[model samples]
Target: MTSLLPRTRTMFPGLTEWFDAAWPFGERNLVRIEEVAAEGEYVVRAELPGFDPEKDVHVAAENGMLTISAERQARKEEKGRSEFRYGSFSRTVALPRGAETAKIAATYHDGILEVKVPVAQTEATGQIEIPVKKD
Candidate 1:
């Protein structure tokens, strides 16, 4: 009944504090997303609960990169050991080679933000034709 990793906080207090300061929440500000390939299109789904899609979410595509960002403010009511995350979160991912940037669309439903990117499907024939020239 022991941990595999060493207890760094106890061994090196100052070092652990510095590491904590450098990354306050350690992946807390990163928006969790999943990329999927659908029929003739690419899809990206982001988990973003407790946020208004109209005002709190923003999506943009530029230079073959798609960016999804959201912001949620902390509540002002009294709290007793709450674990909800707040503040701004963003994630950027590369678009597929044939993704149509202009025709991209997004929708939010049931605490999930889904972005659909139209992409041209490419098929491989597994055989290549090479031309030979006489030396």
Candidate 2:
């Protein structure tokens, strides 16, 4: 089964983004993401604009976990007000119990990164075995 809980980290409960966007010097954490479980696949979408996916984005899977990381350099000589985020950012999520990490796929388009993880389907045998031992 897949976990429906979000694993994103933040300084404050719900104000980290606001504070970061306002101050632009706060300790940054995971990027915003949406996870969905389809009939035969688990999908995750992360919002990452103003970055070159081929050069700045990376995805990896290991030990039943999936991690997405990206880095962006700050623009120089900006006089006007700006609320853009810079530097490195990363987030990791646990893969579902039956997730097929070997066949994972990812794509970037329109400032969004989409990751697809194939899931293996297992049929229920409707039986359980219990072993007992003398103390």
Candidate 3:
């Protein structure tokens, strides 16, 4: 079958060699993460497409820091195949002020690991009415 996309090697003459230099198949074990704050919780999500949360992923929080890591080893039969790299990845995120470390929780679903941390409620003392001058 004819492929609409140009052959990879043709585009970058040395790319194939560069890819195989590290892994048999040019692969990079890069973990992407996103942290967001909403309402009363801070949410952190990491992408671990092929990892099994039970064995390959870990989440830890200490000293106002949250760390997420994932490790995956390629099978013997899968070596030299074009695929995600077989290696370990880790990312550390700084906890925002007032983050409740004790109330943190994590859940993994659909290749994403999400960790939620509660924020201490801020005291809203009272609202002050602005005095406007009438012309």
Candidate 4:
């Protein structure tokens, strides 16, 4: 003779729903970003906690666009145990009309990445030449 037991799905339907809602598609976390503009420069700030300066952070500019990217490893204790995983993030912004690319610079301090983009100077207005035509 054999005995039958209750199915696992029937026992914990609500728990399944809660787990699904908490981590849909098992996404770990989201990165925060912020940008600001100041006189003669455009500043971009990104939050990158617990990242190495030499290995994780990178910045570049090409064709009037500036890109900032970084990768931060999650805490070792929680890497494989929890569903929360933190990975790399890349963000890019288009340079303004008068923004200078050659003079761009960046610095990272206290888990914050700061990029300084110099604004281009405008030329002084000159007299216009108009041709005379017979009516």
- Per-residue alpha-carbon lDDT of candidate 3 for residues 1-135, written as tens digits (9 for 90 to 100): 233445564686455546534455543437778989998899998888878999999989899999998888867774465545787888888998889998889999999999999988787769989999999
* Tens-digit lDDT string for candidate 4 (1-135): 111333264585445444534244554224456778877888888777777867988989998898877776767673355644477877778887688888888888998888899997677679988999989
Question: lDDT of each model, Cα atoms only?
Answer: 0.83, 0.83, 0.81, 0.73
Q: Give the per-residue lDDT of model 1 (tens digit) for 1-135.
A: 233445454675445434534255455434779999888899999999888999999999999999999998988867575546688889999999889999999999999999999998778669898999999
TM-score of each: 0.69, 0.70, 0.69, 0.61
Model 1: how far is 11 from its true place, Å?
17
User: What TM-score would you give candidate 4 relative to the actual structure?
Assistant: 0.61
Measured with C-alpha atoms, the lDDT of residue 17 in candidate 3 is 43
The reply for model 2, stretches above 4 Å from the true place, is 1-30, 129-135
- Residue by residue across 1-135, what tens digits does model 2's lDDT show? 122333366434345445444245554455889999988899999999877999999999999999999998888875785556688999899998899998999999998999999999977677788888989
How much is the lDDT of residue 88 in candidate 2? 91
Q: Which residue pairs show backbone clashes in model 4?
A: 98-120
Candidate 3: regions farther than 4 A off: 1-7, 10-29, 78-80, 123-135
Residue 77 alpha-carbon offset, candidate 3, angstroms = 2.5
Highest TM-score scorer:
2
Better-scoring candidate (TM-score), 2 or 3:
2
